[model samples]
Target: MGPEWAILGATSVSLVLGAVVGLLAIRLQGIYFAMSTLALAQMVYFYCVQASFTNGEDGIQGIPRGVAFGVWDLSTDLSMYYFVLLVCGAALLAIARLVHSPFGRIVAAVRDSEPRATSLGYNVSRYKLAVFVISAGMAGLAGAVKAIATQIASLSDVSWHMSGELLLMVLVGGLGTISGPLAGALVLIGMATYMSELREWVTVVQGLVFVVVVLSLRAGVVGSLSGLMRRRLQAAPRVSAASLPGASAHTSGAG
Candidate 1:
């Protein structure tokens, strides 16, 4: 298939898979949903390992980096990078739109208080299912994109570890924030790349970071920064008012 077609196929497949998982997960909350998704991911990983087309341990290697626009070769790193960036960007944008829509608001509402949403005549389960499916599809898309990026799709792509890693990225980057995952991905991936010699230590570092963030910073890094900015904005008016020539004098006299 053509380069664009391959990307389209990967994106579509990911969306479908994410939607399916999301649908199933949305019915349950908290740890149950997490466990269910993890199990599903493991099942997919095993399937990839056992399936003939995926080539088991050897994986589907040397996948042809197809031609883009029926002209530009995608095999080159530069071309592939741009292609991936574009696809990932588009996916992120799509997700952002979903999160901002009325439907997304309902999903958030369900997350916060399913009973309330249900009482309000909204099918909380259905919304949860829809969002779960969307997230699952996006996860699948990420898997497919990574496979294409490396030109190999193996058991590793669907492993529970991979799911855990994605969850970590979301958490570290700030769940519920559009840019968090991207930042988390970059930081983790970059660190892993640079510390290749200590690959085993990566998990330790991630765990420590997670603990620190959870214990000390309820909001992730981005969330905390956002709060700080909000506080500054809110305090600006107070500061300006206090700076007025008679403001402090009048307050002191009144006291």
Candidate 2:
């Protein structure tokens, strides 16, 4: 199948799966929801490991780099890169719009305090389920692109470690901000490449970074920087006002 087919198939499957799981799991929150999803993931993983159609760990290999609608040949690395960029750009744009929409506001409201949202006559459960499905579909699209880019689909791609890495990326970059995850991914990828030789210590380093961010910058890199810039802007007016000759004198006289 072609890129379009693969992407559509991935997203559709994820949406279905997410809806089913979310319907069953959305009533639960925090660790319970996390555990439920983890259990589902384990089930999928074992199925992949046992299923003959999945190649039993060897995975689906030799996947062809097919052309895009017969117009762009993805066999060439440059063409494939550009195609990936296009797909990613579109996805990011869609995500931006989604996060800024009224639906997104409802999602945020639900997340902050479900009881309050419910009291306000909002269907918190439905909103949660819908967002869950949307998230899964987005993840599926990413997975589809990844498989195409690497030309391989393996169990490792679905492992708990992979899930943890995705969480870490959002935390490191800053949650609730579009640029945060992108920046976090670039940082993590760059670090991984640089430390490829010292792979054993990579996790240790990442953990240390995580700790530092948690203790000193709860808002994460992007969030912290944004806050700092905002604070500076706010303080600038006061500083300029205080610098005026009459302003200081007036304040001193009042004191």
Candidate 3:
């Protein structure tokens, strides 16, 4: 089967699990929501571990890099690379578009002040659930890509540690900003590649790096840089009409 079938599987998984979690979690707010969702995640992880269909901890492996739409051969590394790049690029663009759409604006509004959104007659819970489901589906899409690319899907995919790593990526990348995860991923992947020799210490070093990022770049790499640029732009002196080279002559002639 091609990648399209894989997407359908992922999408179905997301709709079922994500909707369930959203139903349970969306009514609550803040840490409560996080805890509730994580509780479900823990359940799912164990289910994956024990379930027969999931290969009982070993997971579904030996997945082939089949053709894309029966046209593009994904057997070669170069072809796979381009395929992944195209998929990722499209995902990012779609996410960006969604985040800027009116629906996104409403979601942001609901996020900032639920009471206000409610007062404005918005169905806060529905919006929260929709966004939650969409995000979960996208995450599933990522997992599908990783599984297909690596040709494996193991227990580690749904493990608690994997959840922690996902959180770390968001924190390192800047929680709400586009391109933040990409930068964070690059740093983490680069470290993993270079420090493969020190494999055991990689997690420790990652924790240390996370600590550093938390302490120093509170807004994250991309977020902090963008903030800095914005601040500089704001701080720079503004030029008045009187400061223009021809302003005096023009003003005198007018007078």
Candidate 4:
């Protein structure tokens, strides 16, 4: 079936489920939360395995690259790429705007200090739920696009290994920085693609890279750069202030 409408419907359902899951998971912290999420994902994977609609292990393949909105034809590679690019661009812009908004500030506050945010009368749970829903929706959107691009929908997308890989990308890129994921994906994906023949060594090499990054760039590549920039900025103001006092004293002495 070339029904692109299913993509939107699936995304919406996934987002709602994400919010519901977040509401339930919001109470758990640290390892407990991680385990709960992992369990839920595993359950979904089993369900997919049993579900007839998902076509069992074979998955839903041969998905036709039909026209988007019944207007723009995405059957061609160039057109499909541009369509995906537009969607990704819009998502990035939306995320940037969200992070700069008051709501985003509240979410950040909750992340840094839930107790403090709660004391300030903000429902931290709700904030987490909203953020979870947004993240889920974005993920679903990406998956949908990937399915369309590859002309298949497989269980690999929902696998635990995929989750681990995603976490690795975020950690290597920079947890809080917007550009971190992009850079990490570029580097890691490029490495994986190039080293596809050396499959056995790839994992070991990636692990070594992770160890090096953790030992040296604890804040992550982007985060470390951001910290350096901040320090330089602070130093600049101090240097200017010191120079101002010295210049004034020298002028007074000259007078």
- Specify the poorest-scoring 10-residue window by lDDT in model 1: 131-140
Candidate 2, 88-145: lDDT as tens digits:
8998999899989999898899878889999999988889889889989988999988
For model 3, residues 142-165, the per-residue Cα lDDT tens digits are 898888888889998887788888
- Give a tens-digit lDDT track for model 1, residues 111-214: 78878999999977777666666665676567666777788877777677776787777787786788987877886788788878887997788788878877
Model 1 bad stretches (over 4 Å): 18-24, 239-255
Candidate 3 lDDT (Cα, 0 to 1) = 0.88
* Model 4 per-residue lDDT tens digits across residues 1-255: 433686787689889989888888878999999999999989889999999988988999998889888788988999999988888888889999999999989999998999999999998888888988898898888888888988999988888988888888888888898888877777788889999999879988888888888889897788888999999987784456437757888877889
- Cα error, candidate 1, residue 63 (Å): 1.0
Sorted by lDDT (best first), the order is 3, 2, 4, 1
Q: Each candidate: how many clashes?
A: 10, 0, 0, 0
* Residue 226 displacement (Å), model 2: 1.2
Q: Residue 12 lDDT in model 3?
A: 80
Best by TM-score: 3
RMSD of each: 3.5, 3.4, 1.6, 2.6
> Per the 3 Å backbone cut-off, how many clashing residue pairs does candidate 1 have?
10
Candidate 2, run of 10 with poorest lDDT = 236-245
